[model samples]
Target: MILWFTYILVAIAALGGLLCVVLGLAGRRPSDLTVGILGLLELGLIAQVVISIIAPFAGNPPTGSLLEFWVYLVTAVLIPPAAVVWALLERSRWSTVIMGIAALAVAVMVWRMQVIWTVQGS
Candidate 1:
């Protein structure tokens, strides 16, 4: 696991969480900008997955159990899309709340991935 990448993901998720909180507080509905940001975040996650997939084959075996890594990877990849679809269907502040929760989940998963990597390394 790349510590830098994990940090970056955490930062992104934190920012998204802040935005969602602000939107919720201001009584604003989910907007296109929010969706766009979520899309970008999703792309970033996809990139992370791609890099992770290639790293092990490129002589950098992941310092984590393959099964756990796959679970985290798949969930991270699914989150943004799931949030977006749910937001579109809901179209309320609840959508933003859901996005916020999703972002928080991403952060937690990143942390877990890091821990898994560390444990495997030991």
Candidate 2:
């Protein structure tokens, strides 16, 4: 994984999570801003997926367990859509909070994938 891109993704996810949580705590329901941020995050994840696929063949294969990295990537990619669906269906402050939590979770998972790629070598 590219270090800078990973950092950017982490920052975006963290900030997005914080924003949604604060909004929810202030008694606001999910808004387009929140959903849009998550949509951006999902797009980034998809890009990462493509990069991961290409990186291996371009002489930058992960040093850690490929299985573990792929599992994390797949799961991280799923979280945003799930959270957005819940928020849309519930239309409540708690749903916003849940979306925030999901974003935070994705951030951590992405970081872990980075570790697996760059630090944990066989």
- Report the number of the highest-lDDT candidate: 2
**Model 2 per-residue lDDT tens digits across residues 1-122:** 88898998899899999999999999989999999989999999999999999998998989999999999999999999999999999999999999999999999999999999999968
TM-score of 2: 0.98
- Per residue, candidate 1 scores C-alpha lDDT tens digits across 68-107 of 8879878988988899899899999888878877887887
Off by over 4 Å in 1: none
Who wins the TM-score comparison? 2
Error of model 1, residue 82, in angstroms = 0.7
